[model samples]
Target: MAKKVALLQGNEACAHGALYAGCSFFGGYPITPSTEVAEVLSGELPKIGGKFIQMEDEIGAMASVIGASLTGAKALTATSGPGVSLKQELIGYACIAETPCVIINVMRGGPSTGMPTGPGQSDVMQAMWGTHGDHAAIALVPASCQEIFSETVRAFNLAEKYRMPVQVLYDEIVGHMREPVEFPEPGELEVIDRTAPSVGPEAYKPYDTSFGDVPPLAAFGSGYKYHVTGLNKAEDGFPTTKADLVDAEERRQISKVKNPTALADIESNEEYLTEDAEVIIWAYGSTARSSRYAVNELRKEGIKAGLFRPITLWPFPEKRTAELAKQAKAIVVPEMNLGQMILEVERVAMGACKIAGVHRVDGEPINPGQIIAQVKEVL
Candidate 1:
């Protein structure tokens, strides 16, 4: 098969990822860095008989996508920092209701509309714990345009397979940068459609634990009718005040999604000058790109340094990192946020190896030369 190379931006690749993932609907409000995703989807969805709507605001955009998912469509929405904060309530609703959908947050610096065009990974903690109640959520971070394309497909698969809302966490650098990416031809991949109940309406239970941890979803227009609401309820989708039932409902919501072996896992790209070296550089997202360049420069100077890139930001790759920590002399973590993911690196390292953080949150990326200097100091 001949490969076709198209120079594409990260946001456009994300739109293509949704189409390939069987996303038939998109609802979003335009915001910088992330606006391109909504713009591209608005144009592409219609050609494939999919639907696109620009809602009045971010909350409406989030609410609408969840509603569409009830009709058995794989749905999506995109936003930046401020918009992501606006949608947290409905995001919680999607979590409790086990709605299958994808939310792409192309992050920018901010507490409230910080910088529209600049890059920042400030939303890392929010992506995992932003919603009101205690619930398990998965967020996938992509560093490059290729990863944006591939991880978007995985985002949909995780959402539908487990019947939950999943996030694709992209920074501004990846959202706007242009790169070459290859698209899979039709029928080269597997898509998981939401499982529907085989039984009649009377026998159907909304949270049917007997079948599997996941209950089969019944579409709204389907004759097998069911009710869905935000209130804490039992398996049949009805509101209940019973204490134990509410406890059971909440526990299942988290446990079913939080199992690291079952749901959360990490992806990484590493180089092994560490086999004989003392220092290691741990980074991800756009920072990983810089670190990659820095590591090669270190090698040129006869410095033994290795790079460890985490593709799965959440669940934080504890097992692999613990093993890497034992062998290295020192670990350096560089991120756009001030000491966010660095805490995880320290926890897993357990003082067995010296760990230091190189972080900046002023909306500028860390320089590769600065990273190379940090590596040389440790060596």
Candidate 2:
């Protein structure tokens, strides 16, 4: 097969990436900035013998995706910030149920429909904590259309590997921007399928801990009759009120991803000119693009500045940031929201370096000029 190159929008590329990753079902509501994702999948899924459903609301859409995922389909749902807010309960349900699904959140300014058509990174914290409880999350932040495509596939892989919901976080800028992308061939990319049960139907335990931290998931209607609920569950998948069982279940859920070995596999970060730099710009999503340019501009003027962009936002990539803080004099965080990620940077840097935030919440992206100025001030 010839390499396929096309000028694609970020949302469109995300849909394509889902298809390539063997996603067979999409249940989503149409919301600004993210509607293009549903629009593309609606047309594409049927042709590929998959299913596309526009649920009446965001809550229903989230529930439907989890239902489909239970049946062993690589399922997905796309929405903006407000829609994600509405989906929190079901997202939490998916988390506790250990369902594997991909959620694409094209962030718009928000406290409640704050800016439907504008960009904002206000959901950075929400993605990790919006859903109530002690559950782990995997969120991939992509800065470009091409990165969205690749990361969307990676999100599904991670979700299935960990048996939990994974989020692909992009903003209005990257979600709507058009860029040229050459998609890799099927053989060139790695596609992961969920682990299946090894034992007979009668011997199956959906949440079996004896097997491992992440037990094999049995598909619905796969001759396995099992129960799933939002309440803490035992190894057999039944809701448990026992203290020991509840504690064990919660600990397993959190530790599966929190473990250093598992976290290392899911985390991704990009460093630019940071080896000998005295200043570092910590950014992600579209803001990193501006931060990159600012790094180059400062380096040209003999300012030893670099960039540390976290592609994996949820695990937070604290290990890498801590390492950078030990050597750098200062770390400047530029974000679309009012210093959301800066808090995480501060916690990790731990007074090793001065931390400053160049924040914009008026629905405009943080530009290169703003980052350069902040870098100069911090120095």
Among the numbered candidates, top TM-score falls to 2
Best by lDDT: 2
User: Between which residue pairs do clashes occur in model 1?
Assistant: none
Distance from true location, Cα of 237 in model 2, Å:
1.0
Q: Rate the local accuracy (lDDT) of all candidates.
A: 0.85, 0.93
Candidate 1 overall lDDT versus native: 0.85
For model 2, the run of ten residues with the poorest summed lDDT: 181-190
Q: List the residue pairs that clash in candidate 2.
A: none
> Over the stretch 1-379, how does candidate 1's per-residue lDDT look in tens digits?
7866678899999998889999999999999999889888899899999999999999999999999999988999999989989999999999988999999999999889888889998898899889898888778888888789878888898889778898889889889999998887766666678888988988988778787777789888887777788999888888989999999888888777666556433343445465765678888888888888888888888877788887777656777788878988888888888788778889988988988878777878898988877776765
Give per-residue CA lDDT, model 2, range 1-379, as digits (tens). Answer: 6788999999999999999899999999999999999999999999999999999999999999999999999999999989999999999999999999999999999799898989999999999998888889899999999899899999999999999999999999999999998898886778989899999999999998778899999999878899999888888888889999998888889999999899989999999999998999999999999999999999999999999999999988988899999999999999999879999999988999999999998988899999999989988
Give TM-scores for every candidate, taking all chains together and pairing residue i with residue i. 0.94, 0.99
Which segments of candidate 1 are over 4 A away from where they belong? 263-277
Let me know the TM-score candidate 2 reaches against the reference structure: 0.99
**Residue 32 deviation, candidate 1, in Å?**
0.3
